[model samples]
Target: MFAVTILGNNSAIPTLDRHPTAQVVTCNEQLLLVDCGEGTQLQITQYRIRRSKLRYIFISHLHGDHYFGLIGLINTLNLMGRTEPLSVYAPPELEQIIQLQLDCSGTILKFELSFVPLLPGYSGLILEDKDLRVSCFPTQHRISCFGFSIEMQKRKRKLIPEQAKAYEIPAAYFSKLQEGADYQRKDGSIIKNDWVTLSPGKAKRYVYCADTIYDVNLLPWLKDADMMYHETTYLHDLEDRAAERYHSTTVQAASLAAAAGVKKLLIGHFSSKYTELQPFLDESRPVFANTDIAEEGVSYIV
Candidate 1:
């Protein structure tokens, strides 16, 4: 159930078919929105996403394309009678921005909202929940920016049914076995937990490189990800311009993904200059196979 749905993928502006940067990361039943670009609320509605289950949000930067829709989403949540608490992770200055917007509009939310600042000169694990763990790292962008790594932890241990049955363990106790509990017979004999259970399998990870210039320093964060989303704001031909503007090109993004040995790559945040995007694929697939365009409505399973 861990997947990421692309709500908006364009770089600097909205387009007829494309949108600015925003994504919904579904970790089982819980949802962590990565960014809230303009019109993100409508994008959620159009894609049939359940906004009610969103418990946390991570804004990568202060760019309007990254978080301009936060106020609108908060207002709408209040209108919908939401009572659950929501936490937002972003720079320290975002608190003042949100406060100003709410104060100026005389808007009061019906639910609790908290902010966790992603400060400069610091980067490490930021969140650990029942289903997922998230870490943040600084990225080289025009403004202060951070990238997120969402890893889905395996919950249940593998059950060896034959081993359990040989130990006379009852079927009703299997759930307990999966929870790493040993069995005890009526005769007061103990059946060891390891006799019937194995460790949970590997955890799957999804990394989002919000916006950045071409830099090899990101390899550590991108390493061994089950899937990764890196912005390809331009085609390979615009390499010079991309470097000057602090955006990445398709070839640069693909090279990093390939070097990191990620399982799959989802590239988006296309510059509005190019109306056609097929060239991005044509250029990136040479460097990394399994490269995909982050289309607005498609969900890429991590």
Candidate 2:
């Protein structure tokens, strides 16, 4: 169930067929909304995503295309009688912005809303829930933007039923054994936990490089990631424009993914000018064979 579903993939200006940046990261039953761009609420409904499952949101920057839908979505949630608390992680200024809107409209949310401010030039682990860990890092965007790294931890060890049965351990204790607990027989003998269970597998890592220019300093965060999402706002020929705008080109995104040795790469945040997206893949796959265009409404397994 660990996967990311793209809601909007287009950059700045959204069109009828494409939209601004927004995604839903599904970690089992929980959903983390990353970058709620314009039209995000509609996209969520159109994609049949469970809005009730949404627990937290991470906004990369204060750009209109990145978070213009926040106020609308929050208001809609209240109107729909949502009572569950929700947390939003974003730039410090967003807190004031959201509060002002709420005040002007005399809106009192039915749910508990809290905001966690992400300071500029900050990079560290920001969240840890049951089996999910999220960290943030700065990206070289026009404004103080950040990227997110999500790691899904394997909490339970692989249980060996045959080994447990051979030791005459009851099936009722299998849950505890998987949690790395030892079994004690009625005769007062103890069976080691390691004898019947194997260590958990490596954690699955997913890095979202929100928006950035071609920067090699990000290699450390992207290194060996199971999957990564990097914005390719332009084609290779427009590398100059991309640099001027502090955005990334298709070739640049793929090059970084290749250098970082990530298992897979998802490229999105395409500029409105580029109606055709296949060329992006053509430019990226040569550098990283696992590169994929982040298509709206498609879920990529992490």
Against the hidden reference, what TM-scores do the models get? 0.97, 0.98
Q: What is the C-alpha lDDT of each candidate?
A: 0.93, 0.95
List, residue by residue over 43-117, the lDDT tens digit for candidate 1: 999999999999999999999999998888888998999999999999989989998988999988889999999
Clashing pairs in 1: none
User: For model 1, what is the C-alpha lDDT against the true structure?
Assistant: 0.93
* Cα lDDT, model 1, residue 81: 96
The per-candidate count of clashes, in order, stands at: 0, 0
TM-score of 2: 0.98
Candidate 2 local lDDT, 60-151, one digit each (tens):
99999999998988998899899999999999999999999999999988899999999999999999999799999999989999999999
- Model 1 regions lying over 4 Å from their true place: none
For candidate 1, the 10 contiguous residues with the lowest summed lDDT are: 117-126
